[model samples]
Target: MSLPSYQKAAVIEGTELVIKKNAFIPSFEKNEVLVKVIAASVNPTDWKHIDYGSGKTQGSVSGCDYAGIIVSMGEEVEAKGDLNLGDHVYGVVHGSSLERRNNGAFAEFVAASPLVLIKAAKPLKTIAKGQENIPSGPVETFEGASTLGVALTTIAITFSYYFKFDFSKKPLEDDFLLIWGGSSSVGQIALQFAKIYGIKVIVVASAKNHHHLKSLGADHLVDYHDADAVEQIKALGKNHIKFGFDTISLPQTNQKVHSAVSENATTNSLLPFNPKDLEDYRSDVDITVTLAYLAWGKNTKVPFPWMETDENGAAVSNPGFPEACKTFFKVASKALNEGSVKHIPITVLPKGLNSLNEAFDLLRHDKISSGKLTVRIEDSA
Candidate 1:
């Protein structure tokens, strides 16, 4: 296929998103695949990069969470599995990393590690008795699958990677988990994964979302707006909740989560918090932060399912992250097909990539609630 030398992408211009028509389409590395982005979802991370200008340099493309078709692959991808050119996939990339100038997903094409891309699976809907059935195409629309990568990957690391929870076993009847801000994209999916992994969960969110979250498998609900939100959770679980995840990661919510879990429990927060900011919590309670891009950069020490230690007992480089991401993506894709994982509601913007600035502004000003903001990119194919 003859590809374009220049592609359209959204880049940060001071505090706004500038759609550049002549952005370069990133080339793939040895272990990477180049995707023709069909749908791209905007996350809070995108706006944070725009507003704070952290980890960004001149000409860095904006946005992440993409669903697309594999237009090309490096030499190594064929040996990995069924992945190939023209397969539809969705996953996360370090879209705004300054380390790679052409890193972001907002562009018409993106080069992502094969480890981060999950081959999209469509579910079977036909019911024929006493006969074999075959499903066709992706069960999720491009926009629906677009919502999975960042939210699912981060929460997976929080529980499966950081907390070291075993996903192979079913949740014990007595086991309880507590999550704050349960209606957020990460929170909602986290609730689904925890439930499917065999743990009962208590969640704190707005009362209006209570019924919706409960349907997603949250066992107990506490309204965050209620004055006794912590007390309500603590009273119901009574030190039974051992694992805590704070998706909101606000100072007040952190303290409340501290009071809601068991004495020796560990908690994971989406955003990092300084130790001083959490002094009110008991010293015995361990709090760790989960960053979705930990495996993307070269210099990170985040643990993956496949990392190994050197002879000196120091953790070696992230050779296994690609495999780890590939493994988790398969698990998540299965969950999605079987209805164990549900896609969050999304609000799609018009005008393709040009609508990113307005979409990001919705997140920046808190105009969005519960649903994710997505932009359907015009397929250059």
Candidate 2:
């Protein structure tokens, strides 16, 4: 069980972590798992946390998603359930665990909580349920599976309650929904999820990404390029739409959502569905969509099942979030294995132990989008 002296790892090294070589590889608790990272993907949270302290701090690393082979697992963890030594796996972290206090996935090996790392085989179980189009094979390579983490949070955290979406049905002539930043990683998956949920989507995003949104099944696309993006949106609703998710968390996005759902919304805003507070009666439409911001103040202004807050000023857990995550990953795994979703075509840059910085530079310039960047570190099998 000898280890290399200098494994590849992307280190934040300090505030504004600029990737450098010689970062550390983390060790695990008894039940913890050590992943020989196969292909780690850079997500927005990865950069934001590195640049902005948006996630719980470890020491240097700030990435969160990875796909790879398991080299080690805590004794208790191995005895507890399904994970086996040498198994390939992928998952997202809880964001606040000290085990990962500043440790993120931008490295060759990450010691992660067993709870966060689901056995890769689980998602493949859905094929037997008659979910056609899913391949009857191991879930495709890591990046394809790597992108599922944030998408899982968006769906599980923000829209689990609304999962009752009857995709087979059509929206009424006046039904509407406000989707902020439809082009984002989280928004993309949510749109795909929403398609199954039956919402008439009015998506907000940069004009260039509108086509991508349309491909994901957005009903209407609003270019955020214009100063009056919200105004344009509200006019389309003529004030009828309510319900939204602010994946972007921008000040303007907040206002746009408030307007799109508040102006002329016809769903009883006064009584309040979850009944937390009331006064500004968009009274017609009680529900307004907002992404549960982990960085902002809690929104108790209007009530719906989705709103929640924790002591850390983060959105409290949604009731069905964990389950939704499990389900979506299962779906994503199936899609990946079966080829329903194509991996964003790109080079598999398995750069061993020193390429972490290179990955970060590419991400910083917005050089990677729609395509994935990856790294591999172990031959556990």
Off by over 4 Å in 2: 1-7, 15-25, 29-32, 54-58, 74-81, 94-99, 113-139, 161-176, 235-242, 262-338, 341-381
Computed on alpha carbons, the lDDT of every model, listed in order, comes to 0.73, 0.54
Model 2 over residues 1-381: C-alpha lDDT tens digits?
A: 566655555555454444445656676678578877665556655555555553334355656667767887789877886677777777664331233443456666777655435456543211121221221123455645655554554454455434233334566656676777776666766666666556677888888878767876889999888988868887776655756666665544554565567544422111113322333334444453323222112222111223455554434544354454445555555544455443333334544334555666787787754444544443111
Q: Give per-candidate clash totals.
A: 3, 23
Judged by whole-model lDDT over C-alpha atoms, candidate 1 comes out at 0.73
Instruction: Give candidate 2's whole-model lDDT.
Output: 0.54
lDDT of 2 at 194: 65
Tell me, by lDDT, which candidate is best. Answer: 1
Q: What TM-score number comes out for model 1?
A: 0.87
